[model samples]
Each structure stands twice: as structure tokens, then as C-alpha cells.
Target: MLTPQQPLGSGFGAATTTDEVMTGIDLSGKTAIVTGGYSGLGRETARVLRAAGARVIVPARDLSRAREALAGMDVEIAPMDLLDPTSIDAFAASFLESTPALHILVNSAAIMAVPELTRDARGYEYQFATNHLGHFQLTTRLLPTLRNANGARVVSVSSIGHRYSPVFLDDPHFEHRQYIPLAGYGQSKTANILFAVALDQREKAHGVRAFSLHPGAIADTGLGKYIPLEHRVAAGVIDEQGKPVRDPARQLKTIGQGAATQVWCATSQQLNSLGGVYCENVDVAPVMKEQPEKIDMADAMRLTGVVPYAIDPASADDLWELSERLLNW
Candidate 1:
């Protein structure tokens, strides 16, 4: 049976940090792959997991940069670009051949609202390609190792931004509809939740559970590098100088606070039997009572519950098929 999309009241809240979630959790001998593990919440996630004794591998698009950012950390760094299919395949192939098991997979890498319209080599929108399709390809390829583990979990870092748009099944590449940065980003994030839902349904019997979450609006991370300063300032995420700022109207998260939900989703004993639900601030997010007829960026930035469109089982199943077909899997 599917887990309900409601909070378990795990006694954790928005203020919880990544380190706080790791209290008493021992991950010795576990192996984890955290994409984008060199920066932002990804870096913090890798750090805490390593502190708990898990062997973490960080796949980077730039090995030198990853090495520099990850200096002094005992973790493996490999090359893989989410935009490049050949690289993703090679990385997956190598890991499958050498690694005995993959206890955790955190699809934490993503590109947020790019100001301009961009597409991948296949003419797919850049955001959708990187955030959803790429992870889709990577996770499907890693199924064997995940299943081999005693209890494997795949954590996807979705966002409240998911409420900004539904999947544009008809024209995701902006072939017809106008290209709006937030819209593309929203569709991709929505896809992330649907992907997790469909994946958990398929893999739960094999001891693998999948989850998607909003890591909170962290202001200082490189994830917001592409967002224009004015927009961010208006969004209450930063000051004029790019420093993190807190707005009473909209809660702002520190890096540690932002990384908490994914870590909890990946390691919490409370969710051992739970999967396929979207989470926020360390708890399963409630399903929204009604989806807005139009996209509302300001409303989305503050709200918590996930829209029903994101977790619809039919849509999830259909998306899974579409993704597999797109990737030729």
C-alpha cells in the first residue's frame, strides 16, 4: 500500500539541521552516492553522512572544482555531467561493476530557474533534462545495486517550487507554449516527485524505498547562482550584496537547515516503511486541499503542502513510461 501524504509528526521541524538528524545514527559500511555533493546542501549532506561513517561518492562535472571544494573530506570524486548522457552511462557502468551495493542514492543535483530558455542536445528543456530525465536515467541504471542492499533509499531533492507548475506532458520543451523559467523549473520538480512515487511502487518489494522533498529555501547556496539578484531580493532570499537574509514574511534557511530534510528522508528509522511521499522540513508534506488554477511564485515560495498533480499515480506511471521511452531504457 502507498504511504499517506501526511506528516508523522516525527518531532522534527523546520529549524532542524542536518547534523541534528544524524544523532545516534550509525552508517558504518553503507555506501552512498550524492550527486552535486561538492556544493550547497549536497556538500553538507555528504559531510554529515561521512561523519556517520558512510562511504560517500560525489560525482562531479568538474573534477578539479569538486576536489577543491571537497578538500580535507574523505570521499571519492568521479566525473559525470547530468546534461551528458554518455558520461552518466559510463559512471553508472563503472559503479555497477565495482560496487557491491548502493545503500543510498541522493539525487540532490539540480539547476534552478535559468533566466533564458535553454535546451539539451536532444532539444529537451535544460531544467527538465538535468533535474528529472537525467536522474531518471541514473536511478534506473542503478536499480540492481539498490536492490542488493538490505534497505536502500533514494532521496530526490524536490522543492516547494513544484507547486509552480504541473508536468507539461504535451510540450515540455516549450515547442508551443512560451518558455518561462519558473514554469520549466516547476515541471521538472513536479517530475521529481512523480518519479519517486513511481519508483517506490516498482522497487519497494525489492527493499528499496524512494522519497522526494523540499530542502527549504536556502539563500547562500550556489543553487541560486543563476537567479537574478533583484528577483532573489524580492523573494526575500538575499540582501543586495548576496548575503543570506531572513524575511519575517518568508522563512529563510541556513545551509544546515536546508540539508536536513534530505538527510532525514535518507536515514530516518521513522520512515523505514514509508516511501513515495513528498517531504518538507523533516516531515512528510501534507497533500494540498486544492491546486491553484494558475502558477503563483510568491504563494509557492511560502506554502508547504505538495499539489496533488505531483503525486498522481496515473501521472507517475505515465511519466515513468515516457521517461523510459525517452531514454531508450
Candidate 2:
């Protein structure tokens, strides 16, 4: 059965840090793959997991930059560009050849609202292509390795930005409708959630479960580098001085805090029996059935729960089919 979108009262909150959430957990002998794990919350997560004795592999587009950022850490770096389908396939094939099992897969890489419309080789929007489609292909390719692990968890690092818009199924590539940056981003994020829901339904009986989560509004993660300073300030993520505002209550978070939920979902014993749920604040989030009336970014940030449409099972199945068709798989 699908897990309900209700908080588990895990006693962890928005202020929980990666170290805190990982307390008393030992990941020794386990293996994990974290995409975009060179920087931002992804990097922090990789660091924490490696410290906990998991063999962490980070796939990066820029090997030099990844090595520099990951220096002094024991984590391994592999070359793979999310935008390139062939690169993803190559990476998956190489990983499966060397690794017998993958205990955890964290789809932590993503791009935020790009000011301009960008498309991949397939002509899909950049945000959707990178954040959703790329991970979708990677996970499907790595399914054998994941299933090999007796129990494995797939964590999707989605965002509250999903509230900005549901997936534009009718015109996902924005061919018919005018493209808006945030809407494109929102569409991808919603896909992240729906992908988890659908994946869990199919994989849970095989001991592989999936989850999606909001990492809160972390301005230092570089995911928002494409968004302008004024817009961030307006969104209350940063101040006029260009410094990140730390307010866990309002969803703004430090890097450690922002990385907590994904880590929790990946390692928490409490979640062993649960999957296909949307989580925030280091706990399963409740469903917000009513969509707010065209709220601005600031207001959207204050919104606390997952939107109903993002977790709809029927939508999840539809998205899975659409993703397969798009990837030509």
C-alpha cells in the first residue's frame, strides 16, 4: 500500500542537521550514489554518508571541480552529465559492472528557475530535462543494481517550488504555452514527487522503495544562482546585503539543516516500512489539498505541505509512461 502524506512525528524538525538526523545510524558496508554530490546539500550529504562508512559515489559533469570540492574526502567521483543521455547510460553501465548493489540512490542534482528558456538535445526544457528526466533515466538504468541490495531507498531531493505549478502534461515542453521559468521549474519538481510515488508502487514489493522531499529554502546551495539577487531578496531567502537568512521556521536553512531530510529518508530506520511519500522538515509531510490562489514566491516559501496533485498515484503512473516515451526507452 502507498504511504499516506501525513507527518510521522519523527521528532525531527526543520532545524535538524545532517549529523543529528544520522545519529545512531551506521551505514557501513552499504553503497550509495549521489548525483550532483560535489557541491551544495548534495555534497554535504555525501560527506555525511561517507563519514558514516558508506562507500559514496558522486557523479559529476566537471571532474576537476568535483575533485577540488571533494578533496580530503574519501568519496569517489565519476564522470556523468545529467543533460547527456549517453553519459548517463555509460555511467550506469560502469557502476553496475563494479558495484554488486546500490543501497541508496539520492537524486539530489537539480537546476532552479533559469531566466531564459533552455533546451537539451531533445529540445526539452532545461529544468525539466535536467532535474526530472535525467534522474528518471538514471534510476531506471540502475534498477538492477538497486534491486540487488535486499533493501534500497531512492531519495528524490525535490523542493517546495513544486507548489508553483503542477506538471504541464498537455504541453510539458512548453510548445503550445508561453514558457515561464518558475513554471518550468515547478513542473520538474512536481515530476520529482510523482516519480517517487510511482517508483515506490512498482519497486516496493522488490525491497526497493522511493521517497521525495523538500530541502527547504537554502540560498547557499547554488541551485538558485540562476535566479537574480533582487528576486531572492524579494523571496526573503536573502537580505539586501546578499547574505542568506537563516530561519528554519520560515523554511530558510543552513546547508546541514537543508541536507537533513534527504539523509533521513535514506537512512532512518523509522522509514523502513514506508515509501512513496512526500516529506519535509525531516518528516513525512501532510497533503495540502487546496491550491493557493496565485501566490508570489515569498508566500509560496511559507507554504508548509505537499500539494495533492504532486502525489496523485494516477498522475504518477501517467508521468512514468510519459517519461519512458520521452526517453525512448
Candidate 3:
């Protein structure tokens, strides 16, 4: 049975840091792959997991930059571009040749709200292609290694931005409809959650559970680079001085706090039997049945629940099939 989309009273809250959630947990012999591990929340997560004794591999599109950013950290860096399918396949093949098992897979890398419509080589919308489809391809290719662990966790880092829109099954690539950056981002994020639901349902029996989560609005992550400064200030993510506002209660968080939930989802013993749940604030978020009305950033921050469409089982299955068809896998 699926875990209910509701909090389990996990003592941790929005302000919890990665170190706080990982206090007693040990990943000594575990192997983890954290995409986008060189920066932002992903970098913090990689640092903590490595400190916990896990062998963390950070796949980067830019090897030199990744090495520099990860300087002093005992983590491996490999090349893989999410926008390129060939690179993904090569990266997976290379990892499988050396690693016998993968205990944790955190799909934490993503581009948010690109200012204009962009597409991948496959001619698919860039945000959807890189964020959802690319990870979809990578994860599916790594299934054997994940299952070889006997027990593993795949954490998909989604966002509250999913509330902007569900997957557009009819025209996910914006081929027929007008392109809207947030909506495109929203569809990809929604796909991330639904992918977790579908993947967990299929892999839980094999001891490979999946999860998705919102890491809060972290301004420093560089995920919002495309959004204009004025818009960001309006969204309350940053102040006039261009500094991140720290308000855990409003879901605005520091790097450590923002990295907490995905790290928790990846390593917390509290989630041993739980999977396919959309989480926030370091716990399973309640499901909101209806799409919320248009609200400002402050109001949106106060709303932390996952929408039903994003976690619906049927929609998950549908997305799985659609993704498979699109990837031709």
C-alpha cells in the first residue's frame, strides 16, 4: 500500500538543517549519486552525505567547475549532461561498470523558469527535457544498479512550483499552445512527483523506493537566475539589497535548511517503509485536492501541500507510459 500523503510528526520542521536530520544516521557503506551536487542545495547535500561516510558521485556537465566547487570534499566527479541523451547513457554505463550497487539516487539538478522557450536536441521543451525526461532516462537506465543494492532510495527534488500546472499530456512541449516559463517549469516539476509515485509503485517490491519533495524557496541556489531581479523581490525571495530572506515559517530557507528535506528523504530511517509521497518541511506533505487560486509569493509560501494531480496514481501511470514513449525506451 502507498504511504498516506500526510506528515508523520517527524520532529523536524522547515528550519531543520541537513546535519540535524542526519544526526544519528550512518551511510558508511552506501553509494549515492547526486546530480547537480556541485552547487546550491545539491552541494550541501553532497557534503553532508560524504561527511556521513557515503561514497557520493557528482555528475557534472562541466568537470573543471565541478572539481573547483567540490574542492576539499572527498567526492567523485564525472561528466554527464542532462540535456544530452548520449551523455546520460554513457555516464550510466560507466557507473554500472564500476559500482555494483547504488543505494541513493537524488535527482536534485534542475533549471527553473527559463525566460524564453528553449528545446533540447530532441526538439522537446528544454525545462521538461532536462528536468524530467533526462532524469527519467537516467533513472531507468540505472535500474539494475539500484535494484542490486537490495534496498535503495530515489529522491526526486520537486517544488511547490508544481502547483502552477500539472503535466500537459496533450502538448507537453508547447508545440500547440503558447509557451509560459513557469507553466513549463510546473509541468516538469509535476512530472517529477508523478515519476516518484509511479516508480515507487513499481520498484518498492524490489526494495527500491522513490520519493519527491519541495526544498523550499532558496534564493541562493541559482535555480532562479532567469527570473528578473524585480520579479524576485516581488516574490519575496530576495530583499531590495539582493540578499536572501530567511523565513523558515514562510518556506524561505538557507542552503542547509533547503537541503534538509531531500537529504532526509534520501537517508532518514523514519522513511524506511514510506515512498511515493510528496514531502515538504522534512515530512510528507498533505495533498491539496484543488488547484489553489492565484496567490502572491507570500501567500504561496504559507501553502505547502502537494496537489492531488501530482500524486494521483492513475496520472502517474499515465505519465510513466507517456515518458517511456517519448524517450523511445
Candidate 4:
């Protein structure tokens, strides 16, 4: 696989904040849509974007909570649930009716290490359905509005857990395999990267750029809420002390740190000529080349090279076709 990940020295690092990333940048009159903006990194992102002068719109499943989350902030909350096609359509349609230009979109919502085998209305495995497909349809539906803006950016919040596994193409919906939650989460994370690949390929020509990001680990993030405590113990992610174990698995970034990379990808002039790359902690990620068990990140800095099963163009096409059919788009 080709290694496409290269750092351009943007000067932002793991410690950078969203505000630092956007310093001196002006987003006035530009519109941004942040999914899951009511909590965690999403809320931090909205805060920085608003501070930087952008008009922020949050598409949240819970309107009441969203309002409270951003009270007194210059933000708008719209009702949209990724798993529900009607909700996504209604929200997108309502937003587009008022404007043709959209500048920034952050697909910053997801579940991690969920406990049960849940499915969406159309029976899509919940992880893949919500984390990947929902964002897929949302972005596709809003493509025209974004393209009209020129230089628009789309950010997909993925996870390093993508390293756990790729999309099992033949059994993507877990029809045959035993249901393992982390594996399901991994598939969805992998899809987030591939979605950016497909999206940037198609939309860059229209002046819209797409990026995928791994927002670090479980520091007070919603993703952790779904993780089973028993599993966490066995994995040594948490010890008898009920605190995170000292390992890469348990290490997490602060919410502000977690929001840095996507914000950087959104506004940094250093990335001015780049698109279609996966980033983490404010920089391009190295390509991963090894099979899940054998590959070390250093040996595989292929950020653009998601696992073959993950980035398979054929599978991507198949998934897109299925999503459109499911959403009735």
C-alpha cells in the first residue's frame, strides 16, 4: 500500500486547542454544521467556531439538551437523528431552503464499544449505520450546498480503534459472525475513513474537501458510556482503582485537545493544498500497513491506506448503493 500521510508542520500538536487552531482565522458569515454538538468534543468545537466568528448550527437528536448545551452562545440547534432517514432529510432540507452555501461540516458523533447488537430502522448494524452511513447520506444530501460555497470542508470523526478491524465486507451486518461490539465499532471507524476517500474524490473537483479524524481515546466522551465495564476491566483499560490503566488503550486527550485536529483541518492554511487525508491530534496520521495483529503504526504510515477490506472501492460503491436504497435517496 502507498503511504500518503505526511506532516506539513502546521505547528499544532496534541496539546493544541480548537481556539488555538483557529486563531486569526475569520469564519464570519460562514455556516458550520456540527453533529453531536451537544456534548464532548463536539461542544468544544462549536464553542471555538462561534468564538472565531462563524455562525454555528448544531444538528442534534435532542433539541432541548442542545439548546441548554449552547445557551447564550451564537448557535442554532436543529433536530436530526442520523439513524432516521426522515430526520436527516427534514433537517437537511430545512437548512438548504434558507441557504445554498455551507462552509464547514463536522461529523463528530459516534458510539464506541457498544454493549448490545442494535440495528437501525432498516436493520443496518447500529455502529455502521449511525457512525458511517448516517453521515454518508447527510453529506451526500448536503453536497450541493457545500459545493456552492467553494473551499468547503467536511470532517468525519473516526477513532484509532479502527486499527482493531476492517469492515467484514461479506458479513458487514453481522449476519453470520458472532456479534462482538468492538469489532462492530472498528468496522464503523474504518468506514469513516473510506467515506472521506470517496467523498473527497468526488467533491474536491467542486471545491469541497473532506477529511477523517481519530479524536483520541475515551476521556469523558460519549463513546465510553456505551462501553461495557466488564469488558473494560478485562482489557485492562480500567484497573481495580477504577481509573484508566497506563497504556495506549486507556490514554485519552482532553476535549479541547480532541477537537484540535478537526478544527485544524478545517481552517489551517498549512493544509490549504491538501484533502482526502486522515488526521489525529492536529496532524496527518501515518499509513497502517500491517495486518491488524502484526502491523505497527510506524511501519505503516499510510494514512490514506485504510485496510484493503476498509478502502475497497468496490465495497465502498456497494455500501453507498445500499445506503441510498435504505435512505430511499
Candidate 5:
């Protein structure tokens, strides 16, 4: 049976930090891949995993910058660009040649709220291409290595912004309708969840399970760099000067706290028997009523659970097929 999207009361809450989640859990001898691991929540994830003795591989778009960011982290940096299929394939090929097993895969790289519409190398929507399709192709390409592990886990970092829009499969690249950055971002994040659900269905019997989660609204991260400061201030998420608003209702988390959910999803032993669920705050998130009209800070926090459209089995299956056709894999 498919796991229901409901909290299991895992005793962890919104305040949990990455280090707190790693307590008493050892990842020694495991191998992990964290995309975008040079910055933001991804960097912290790589750090905690490495501290637990896991060999982490980070795929970077800028080799020099990644090397500088991860100077003493003991991670392997490989060149990759989510927008470039050839680059992705080359990186995957190189990793497969040397890696025997991949115990964890964290699809944490994403772009959010770019003011203007952008397309990738293949003429696909930039948000969808990088946030969803790129990870989809990478996970599939690395399937063999994942299956080699005893019980592999794939954690796709989705977001609360997923509520902004469902996958516009008909015009995903904004060929007909206008491209709105927030809507584009939401569609991509929703795709992340659906991808996880469908992937878990296909690979669970092979000892691989997939999960997706909202890491919470975190401050001091590169993910929000593209969002205009004025808009954030208008939303009450940040001050006029660009600092985070100190509001309990805003549900803002520290970078370490924000990384908790993804790390927990990637390495927590409690999730061994469960797969294909959307999680938040370190537990299986409950399915919430669709609240498309609510986009403010408080509503964003209140609507923390997965929406119906996101976890729909039919939608998940359809997205998988669409992805396969798009990538021709």
C-alpha cells in the first residue's frame, strides 16, 4: 500500500536543527549525492552527512566556486549544469565509473522566483528544467548504483511554494499562457513531490524509496536572492532592509533548522518502511485542503501539508510519462 500523507508524530518539530536530527544516527560508509551542495541548505546537508562519516559527492555548476565553498568539507566536487543535458550526462557517467553504490540522493538544487522568464539549453522552462527534469534524469541515470545499495533513499527538496500552482503539463513552458515566476516555481516544486511519489512506486521493490519535503522558510540562503527585496518586505517575510522579519507567524527557520527536514528524510531510520510521502518539520506532513488563495506568511505556514493535486497518484504517473517523453529516456 502507498504510504498516506499524514504526520507520524516523529517527535521532531519546526524547531529541529540539522545537528539535532543527526544525533545518535551514524551514516558511516554510506555514499550520498547532494546537488547544489556548495551553498544554502544543501551545504549544511553535505556537512552533517559528512560529519556522520558519509562520503558525499556534490555536483556544481562552477567548479572553482564550489571548491572554495567546500574547502575542507571532504566532499568530491563534480562539474554539472542542470540546464545542460550533456553536462549532466557527463557528470553522471564520471560518477558511475568510480562509485559502486549510492545510498542517498538529495535533489536539493532549485531556482525560485526569477523576475523574468528564462529557458534552459533545451528551450524548456528554466524552473521546471532545473528543479524537476534535471533531478529526474539524474535519479534515473543513477538507478543502477542506487539499487546496488542495501536500501537506498532519494530525497527531493520541495517547498511550501508548491501550493502556488500545479504542473501545467499542457503549457509547462509558458508557450501559451504568460509566465509568472511564482507560478513557475510552484509548478516545479509540485513536480518534485509527484516525481518522488512516482519514483517510489517504481523503485521500492528494488529496495529504493523516494521522499519529498518542504525544508521551511529559511533566512540567509541563496535560494531567495532572486526574489526582490521589496516583494519580500511587502509579504512581511523580510524587513525593508532585507533582514528576516522576526515574527512567530512567519515560521522562519535558521539555515540549520531549515536543513533538518531534508536531512531527516535522507537519513532517519524511522522512515525505513515508508516512502512516497511529502514531509515537513521532520515528519510525514498531513494532506491539507487546497488553499490556492492563501499566499501570505501565516497562510504559508498554516498550509504546510501536501495539497491533493500534488500527491495524486494519477498526476504522479502522468508526470513520470511526461518527463520520460521530455528527456527521451
Candidate 6:
């Protein structure tokens, strides 16, 4: 199994910013696909990437609203619904039709901690299917673009929730007993890290690298708006002031700060020579050996060190196969 490949003290700690980390780097002439890049940390990511000279493509589900939000921003707005496989295919096809090489792909679009068990059109559970499986299919379908890049990187935005549970290989769709939203969601998030590990191992031979990120908790960005209010309070993300405490753990980052790690992962020179680790803020997280008290322990475990589940190549391959079957890819 792959271990925490972190060089001793490799990370620059957790408070790095997109612009600060991206200093002296120029992404000129590169094409980047940032899902949900028009809102929240995604929007901030898009802004930074564009600032560094990469052409940014913000594929969003709600084009009108996304465009309105992204108005006057130097980004290309495209339509993509993660819940719809057909939409995923159409977006891929359309992009490939443009005859371009892809240098960066950030799967930052996700829904967190919802109330119920809902399924997409293909009968796949909503959270798992959209957050992990959709990106899986999208990545696979865009393999050609990824392969053609100079040195492409696929960055998946995973939360600290992977500790909720490892991949439930037995019943990924909750067919066996019950569908707990958080558990199923954890399974999907774990799959995200595994996907990066496995994909990097395979794609490094082709000059393509894959990575996963945890952007920290920023409820105001509408990142976790899908999670009901009660859950937010229960999660301790909200305070009596009806606001995020800015210190998710005594010093939490703002929305811009939350987006920093992801953008850094996507465009930082510090990571130019590395690939296939989970990062938070601007630094790659250290191995989290214990369960966190209130924050996302699962995510910390995955990012900080090599969680056994994420390092298992067989498990990742298994997940890939399961995703293929579910998506009918």
C-alpha cells in the first residue's frame, strides 16, 4: 500500500493562499476545467487561475445563475449537471470537440450533508453518485484530453468527511440495509482520494497527475447550503451569532481562505514536482492518526497520511469498476 509519501516537513503549513503560493508561476496557454468554478471557493479558484493566465472553464449545472454570478469575470461558462450522465457526456464531447489539450481539471463541485436519500436518474444515490461517480465518469470520458496535456493534473475536492466510512464495497447503493446520508457520503469521499492515488499511479506514466483536496469548512459560500440549518448547527459550523466562527477550529479560514488550498493545489509550483496526496489549505496535510473531536476526521486522515483504504489499489480499482457499472459507462 502507498504510504504518506510526504517528504519530512514538506508542506508550508495550512494558511497558504492561492496568489501567494502561485508566485512566479505562469499558466499561460493552458486550459483548465473547474467544475462549479463560478461560486464559492470555486469562483475564487477560477479567479486565481485566470489571474495566472490559464484559460478557465467553469462548467456549471445552472448556467443562467452561474453566469449571473460570474458576470464580468473572465471565464467561460458551460453547462454540466453532475446528476445527469448525458449532461456529463455532452460536456465532455463538446469540450473535446474544441480540439484542445487540457492541463488542469478540478472536480470542486459537491453537495454536503443533506437530509434524505435521493437518487439520480440512473438510480444511483444522489451524493455518492454525483460527488464521486459523476467525476469518475467525466474523468474517464475525458481521458484523451487529459492524456494530451503537457503535464495535466486532475484535482478532486474532497471533504474531511471520508472518515465517516470507507467504501462500502458490499452495498455501494445502500441496497442492503439502510441509507444513512453521511455514511454513504463518506464512502464517496473516500473513493475520491483513492481515485487520485490510483489514477496518479497509472497516469504518471502519461504525464498526468491526480490529486484530492479538502478546502476546509466555509458554509457561507453555499458550498454546504444543501445541508439543512439544523445539521449546520449540529456540525457547529454556525454560532449563536448565526455566522461561521471564522475559526472552524479556533482559526478557520474565510471563503477565500478556504478556496486557497484547492487553487494552490491546482497552480502551485511547490507541488509541481509532486502528485497524488490529499491537501488542505496550501500545504499537504499530515497523517491524522486519531479521530477528530468535532471537525472532519475522515478527511484529515485521508489527507494527513495514507489511510489504508485510500492506498489500496485493489479497492480503488474495485470502486472504478463499481462506478462504471453504476454509470453504465
For model 6, the superposed segments whose C-alpha errors exceed 4 Å read 1-3, 7-11, 226-231, 248-251, 290-306
Backbone N/Cα/C clashes per model: 0, 0, 0, 5, 0, 8
State which candidate, 1 or 5, has the greater lDDT: 1
Instruction: Tell me the tens digit of each residue's lDDT in model 1 across 3-35.
Output: 999999999988888989999999999999999
Return the lDDT, model 5, position 52.
Answer: 96
lDDT of 2 by residue, 112-222 (tens): 888888888999999999999999999999999999998999999999989888998878988888888889999999999999999999999889999999999998989
Mind giving the per-residue lDDT tens digits that candidate 3 earns over 20-127? 999988899999999999999999999999999999999999999999999999999999999998999999999999999999999999999988899887899999
Question: How would you encode candidate 5's per-residue C-alpha lDDT over 207-229 as one tens digit per residue?
Answer: 99999999888757878888777
Error of 3 at 171 (Å): 0.5
lDDT of each: 0.91, 0.94, 0.94, 0.77, 0.90, 0.76
Colliding pairs, model 4: 286-301, 287-300, 287-301, 287-302, 287-303
Candidate 6 local lDDT, 1-329, one digit each (tens): 24355543535545556666667879999999998787888888888888889899988889889889888878899889988889989999999999569999999888766667777777777778888988988888888988999688899988777777788877777778687777877788888988888788778878788888777767688756666676666556776666875663432567777877777777766677578788765667665656554445223322344345654678878877777777665
| Candidate 6 vs. true structure, TM-score | 0.90
- Model 2 CA deviation exceeding 4 Å by range: none
> Each model's TM-score?
0.97, 0.99, 0.98, 0.88, 0.97, 0.90
State residue 6's C-alpha deviation in candidate 6, in Å: 2.7
TM-score of 3: 0.98
Q: Record all residue pairs in model 1 with backbone atoms less than 3 Å apart, i.e. clashing.
A: none
lDDT of 4 by residue, 43-144 (tens): 988888888888899998988988998898879998899988889889989988998899999999888767788887778899988998889889998988
Which candidate model has the greater lDDT, 5 or 6? 5
